[model samples]
Target: MSQFDAQILVAAFELSYNDWTLGLRKSNMQVDVLLQNEVLRRGSSILEQTASSLSILPAENADIEGSNLSLRYDDGALLILGEMSYFDLEGLFVDTDSFYLTTGYRFGQWLPHITYARLNSTDDDIRRAPRIETIKNNLPAGSADQIAVATVQSLAPILWNQESTSYAIGVNYFFSPQVVGKLEAKMVTDRNGTISQFQNANTSGASAPVIPDDNRILIYGLSVDVVF
Candidate 1:
């Protein structure tokens, strides 16, 4: 299909007094895809291959809209931040929402922080598509076309959707004005059988990927940074 166009608007505000500072920001975005005719044609072709008498028709233009809001506050010794974001893809039949929060405290030359984040996605629109509905209703239960459609519908959400939560704790040490040492540990847990962002481990020697039974993982990291 044709390319998409996007428009965005943003606003931000900040205040600082003595050693305390606070900031807020908001943004909105819209994306439009020029694929109505192409989509209908392809959808109709798929139905024809399945020997369905139904034909797909053009619908509303494909579009996605999203918004984000965030806030941050910091004093000489304490820091806090939070953000939320959401997106609705009208044509693709997908919606996503996410949240994040972090807090940290500084003591002399050291700072320790903890963070939490969550992401969720759904494809209710895809399940409600005319082409998919036709296939589900018209095709035989064991037919190839029916099986293919069912497989795709079952795997799409697992491969492209997300429902996960993450928690992390980290500490930073200022070795000097221009150098720092950092250590961090993080844990991620998959939710609702979604694995869109996780790395799947393979043990079967087969080329195909396999999901891990344990959906939770812990990661450790250490680093040193020097700025000149």
Candidate 2:
């Protein structure tokens, strides 16, 4: 048996005077796992026996909470935006703290902007997996339990334990009040020797473990938006 429940609340305010406008927004969310099946507990042998039948491992009884706040200011020609967010995932994933900021100016139908953003894991040391050799050396050689424990420990760090910073520049062209086109270029740099959400494309094979590569990535995006 498994049970889950969640609640969310949002509040926003806006004030406008002539050509200047200011706004604030806040949100909070909480999730509670009321019940969990016995078979789903960590280190349960049922998962190995029935691995093919299960597609997901549900969280045990835990509380997951998050909140965010944002402030914005926009005049007829200039705009500024900022936001901060945090999450406590209760070990379902790595807890995270993030921030974002943007500044933009409008000229006729064209709006150009610059943005800076950062995301950091608050519990990186706890989530990082121990090396396989370290785990094996401490355990009895060729023990049946050795392989099982080693595999799990080696894969733990793959669970979103990284930090990154991003810088972006973009332009939005307003075709009308309801339509817009955007072009953006962004660069993401890894921090603290951690791989920030990027997977290695050169995996050896299914039998090989996929590792995170420490490298910077550049992204280019073009898109159009239409509002009904």
Model 2 Cα lDDT, one tens digit per residue, 1-228 = 446676776777777776555566655555554335332233223222333111122233344556676777787689888888887665424678999999999999999999999999887664442433454466677665566545444444563566889999999999999999999999888665565665443466674335445467788999999999
- Model 1: lowest-lDDT 10 consecutive positions: 52-61
- Model 2 misplacement above 4 A: 1-58, 128-149, 199-214
Clashes, model 2: 0
Which one is best on TM-score? 2
- Candidate RMSDs in order: 6.4, 6.6
Tell me the whole-model lDDT of each prediction, alpha carbons only: 0.65, 0.64
TM accuracy, model 2: 0.69
Q: lDDT by residue for model 1 over 141-166, one digit each (tens)?
A: 77665665554445444444667899
Instruction: Give the top-scoring candidate (lDDT).
Output: 1
